[model samples]
Target: MPVATFSLVALDCPDPEALAGFYAGLLGGEVQKYNDIWCDLRTPDGIRIGFQRAPGLRPPSWPRADDNAQQLHLDLTVSDMEAAQERALALGARPLDLDDDGGERNFRVYADPAGHPFCLCRT
Candidate 1:
């Protein structure tokens, strides 16, 4: 038996609305703002992601194992890697790992506007 069912993943960032918008654009979601400091996005695929205001928040560092390690990352499945990469970049996702063993890998890494790392996985 499961101890708890999944609810949502909340991220701490300097601007909640901006982060929410970023994800909403990529994930095809409706963004709701509770206040200047809080925002929630319910993706079209039915995943809920929350963004909370954190003054002086430091975004996570990717491909790292130090104190600034990547604490969490979202994996999004896609059909066309090139098109998805272009869309993600257009939506403010910065490439973290473009060289995935010269296309041998099944995923690519990127950092969201808030600097959290995520992957666009090939389906």
Candidate 2:
């Protein structure tokens, strides 16, 4: 039997509201701010993602195995890869790795405003 149920994933960011806003834009969620140091987004699909303020927190480096690396990332699936890519960029997502093996690969990597890496996967 399971010991505990799944809960939200909280990310450490410089600004909780700003980071939550970025995810809210990309994921179509409602941002709820409890305070200046904490905020969370409830997605349409019912996933809760929390953003907590972490002053002086350094964003992880992508594709690295060193001390600072991509500790975790989110994968979002989209029906239209091109459109999703454009939308993500418009919402302040920086392209980390868009080389999808000449359109054969099904996923592309990007970094949110706070530099958290996420992937827009083709469905």
Candidate 3:
């Protein structure tokens, strides 16, 4: 058997509360602030994403394996790619790659407010 079960994914950023709020807005989650250095978003699907304060953090330069690589990313599935893109942009997610072959591809990439890369995949 496995030695451990899945747990939350914690991200290091400058502002934990703000990062948690961003994810909360995008993922329909409840934001819980534990302290000045830590916050988390408990999603409707019971996925807990924690955000911790890391001052002077350098967010990854996504799509570039050299230099500062994309350490990690979150893939979110949606039914309407267009609608999801709209919402994500409105909520401060910068588009990294939206050229999905005119909707032929299954996923598109974006960078969060903290510059963390994430994808909005079509279901």
Per-residue CA lDDT of model 1 for 59-83, tens digit only, reads 8988977888889999999989999
lDDT values for all models: 0.91, 0.93, 0.92
Which model, 1 or 3, shows the larger lDDT? 3
Per-model TM against the reference: 0.94, 0.97, 0.97
lDDT of 3 by residue, 40-108 (tens): 899999999999999998899978797788899999999989899999999989999988998888999
Clashing pairs in 2: none
Better model by TM-score: candidate 1 vs candidate 3: 3
Clashing residue pairs in candidate 3, if any?
none
lDDT of 2 by residue, 50-111 (tens): 99999998889998868888899999999999999999999999999999998899999999
Error of 2 at 89 (Å): 0.5
Q: Which stretches of candidate 1 lie over 4 Å from their true place?
A: none
Residue 70, model 1: Cα distance from true site in angstroms: 1.1
Instruction: For residue 13, give model 1's deviation from the true position in Å.
Output: 1.0
How does model 2 score by TM-score?
0.97
Q: Which candidate is the best by lDDT?
A: 2
